[model samples]
Target chain A: MLGDCRDWHDVSVIEVQELTKTFGTVRAVDGVSFTARPGEVTGFLGPNGAGKTTTLRMMLGLVAPTSGRALINGRRYVDLERPVVEVGAALEATGFNPGRSARDHLRVACTAAGLPTRRADEALETTGLKEAADRRVLGFSLGMRQRLALAEAILGEPRVLILDEPANGLDPAGIRWLRDFLRHLADIGCTVLVSSHVLAEVEQVADHVVIVARGRVLRDAPLAELVRGGELKVGTRQPEQLRRALEEAGATVRFEDDRLWVSGVDAEQVGRAALDAGAVLTELVEERSGLEHVFLELTRAEMGEAG
Target chain B: MIRLIQAELLKIRSTRMWLGMLGLSVGFALMGLVFYIALAGVEMDGREALPPVTDPDTVRAFYANASGGVLFMMILGIVGITGEYRHGTITQAFLVTPRRGRVLAAKLVSYFLFGLAFGLVTVLATVAVALPALAIRGGSTSLLDNDVPMILGGTVLAMGLYALVGLGLGALIRNQIAAILVAIGWVQLVEAIVTVALPQVGQWLPAGAVRAITRTTGGFGGMGELDTLPPWGGTLVLVGYGLVFAVIAMVTAVRRDIG
Candidate 1:
């Protein structure tokens, strides 16, 4: 889906190696590791209280990790000469002084980043907040605040973007817009690492997914690869006969409600086995699993193990 | 570094609190000057006779008391640091300039300047009221003679230095309300009582150091003047307090994680 790639270099890569953070007696983030490359949207997916925010904070140097590192382009965040020019982070929507105007907020960020103040206006236009540019943030809705946060994040046009739950307060239309925005950013070779508790939102926009549970990485892979292999659901009158034939054909078959849930074989193989068994097929469809199912299953399994 | 300082100044200037604080500061300075002028040379039952405005000491006292607005400058400095945590903007501040030390250093410089501005306005207001009132009250307009200019310079320095002290305190105590309360309570009550009760010990405190800067003598409520350090000595003590607090704050902040 990425086009118009800008020959992006490896300097935009984000590397988190064995990062961990502990608060008092609670271990918030424990040994999390992942890498996000340029030109791809990496979704850091997890449930609430699963250390996603803590990890992101550590990555941005807002929090110190116990025993590991989160490096952007082989340098620590605090070591970057001009951090905003290289990486932009919008940790939350509430990171605003309510009394300050929206334009002034971005202008502060722009000034800190050593960018021209006019970029603040450009970012306002980009985020569709030009009209509210002069208004104090106290009057803004949560969705507008989220938009303003996004606008601030992109003020420097940094090569790397780290946004935590960018779609939290957005409406459906706003979510769609954010999805497209992220895709456009990735298309232009910006490394985007977005964290979300909602799997569907990330599933729509993330090229790569890093699923975490209880402060541990569960599954990390491309979205396409994770959702590629799925079970096939075969409906028939003779469920017992279809199960026997499918098992004999080296397929794992389970009979449930007059249907056979078949795995370990493709639809074509299942059809051939049904024909040989003279099973009157009612429905045969590939149940390609979405990230939601895999996410639920992995997180559930992890929870079960912990419990 | 300059950009960071500019950002810090912008952050302060964009807020309405600074303007309100400025108004209050100027008003407080003028109010104190007018009250002192009205009461000059007047005697009350069970109290010492008021010294006339022509008295060099009384005139010096007017300039010294003119710095009542220093309290607001301290608050401005405190808000400069604590507001970031209160509003959750420190995260963005750090993100924009990852080196937390630089962010704090910028704040220290900016708040110092802000406090200086507040001091300048209050000083000008004091001169406006003191000169006219002194002239009408048959006092010499020799306000610029002798230690008067020294006292004025010291007042400005006290305001600027106190701001750094406030910034340091705010950094050490991130809670906005708690820091503000501690600052006000200490300056207005605890320090006042301590200075009155134990002149030797109180003279070493931050407030006493300020009195030294302005060469303020005598205590509240007809109490006798406590022994104070020389003006330069007071400036040294106050600067030492600011530096110590700032160094401690920087050390703690560099290690403390932002939650």
Candidate 2:
């Protein structure tokens, strides 16, 4: 299964072109499309149950897409010769055998990918799991398992990395290390795609963010754009009045759940309008117009649209 | 393919399973030797070890019982593939290879080799332990003279086929516990019941075919009479069973989503 695949030719872009996966009557992933570019860390972010894992599974060819393709380097994941060397995917924490040692688990990956077994040792050391390298995974903590999974992913020294929730069970220090590690990989020209539901986690590490909701891409752009787009959340009994007042104040207002989502303006202006209108306030909080706001608002919009 | 098989072998090397299995084969062979030696002089009224002292049947039975150890080899193959799904390592395996067929093929090859080793170990251990007893009993322990080589060779062949059957079953049944239970249950209970109810059909079953191949009646003593196909015919039947398992397993593997 090796030696015949075409050389990738600087084409380490991960493209999910209209990927759709339906289970029974439900569409777990509905036409989700996003591209992860080379030499950058792309965050595939979405709220829980928004098809993040399903999309990752599809990208790795573990789950077949009902319609569409997830291509990396101009090829499906299964088409690549020595795919582990070219595209490393760690999609689940439940992938390793608990009875096997960390080194053994990584060695299996190394062997399967036709890489030298020494790569397992190298990966263990790189992931800071050298101390527990010989220990059975049945005794390892969640953090250790994640690290071991990471070690396996890098066992082949792949050019592209796709990790699903790599930071899900890490300590703060571990998470910080992972963020820096991904940054380092991207700096070295590896295409890195990391998925997480926590916007704050990906916010620090991702150069590009593909915010998804209900199996659809909501925002796909540079992280900088989402950072500057803050939302001034105004909660009041007279939501309609606040929505009109905020709009009249030249703010882009979206009325939802009896709350006024005033964008393109600060909370101070929205607060003043509520004050003058004599609308009783329940809550008025200024949320930074970052990934979190986009994630929440987009998910809420999806809920409303579905309703 | 060689690399894949190497990886599969490495997976077992890190665990205590291989050592445990090897020890079990030796233990079974030792037990068989002891059982034969102890029972050689037993009688309801203290009768002699008769049935003609040098008829070769006693030694043949003693060696053929070692084939009983190959059941572990079958379980080894079953656990080799099903253990991946049982422990959720198939996810990692599929990720590393991305070609389920290769993973399956690698397992078939690796487990077949392991099973053969198991058979060799058991038979050699039986011979090692039995030779001293035979010498003590004033009988010549000539392995080449009594069709011992043919019997042992046939046992090894059966071991490989059994492992293939185990691999195929494991593939067809992704649940390890369920597969193991079904494999054993079908042999011990289902087939036993069927054989009692329909003797001819039962003799054609895979277990019966294995018995035919090894020239041993299914029991602890390796002594009984039952209808069986010719040695080669039984082998073909067993091989057919293995192939059926492989075909079904590969088809299901391609269609089923990796959990």
How high a TM-score does candidate 1 get? 0.94
iRMS of candidate 1, one decimal? 0.8
lDDT for each residue of candidate 2 in B1-259, tens digit (9 for 90 to 100): 8989988889989788778777876787678668767766456366544332254767676677677666666677778878888777888878778888888888877887887888887778888878887888766588886667767887787777778888878888877888889888887798777766765787789877776776666653334556667778778897888778767667777667764
Give the lDDT of residue B78 in candidate 1: 82
Q: Tens digits of per-residue lDDT for model 1 on A1-307?
A: 1234555544448999999988888778889999998889999999999999999999999898998999997788998887887887888888899999999999999988889999999999998899999999999998999999999888888889999999999999999999999999888888999999998899888999999999999999999878766678899988888888999999988877767888888889988998999998999988755578789899999999999
Model 1, B1-259: lDDT tens digits are: 8999999888988889889778877888788777788788787785545677667767776776667777787788788888898999988888887788888888888888887888888888888888888889987678677477877787787788778888888888989899999999998898889888988989899888878887776353321378788888888998898788677567766677887
* TM-score on alpha carbons, each prediction: 0.94, 0.87
lDDT of 2 at A42: 94
| Residue runs of model 2 more than 4 Å from their true location after superposition | A1-12, A232-286, B45-53, B219-224
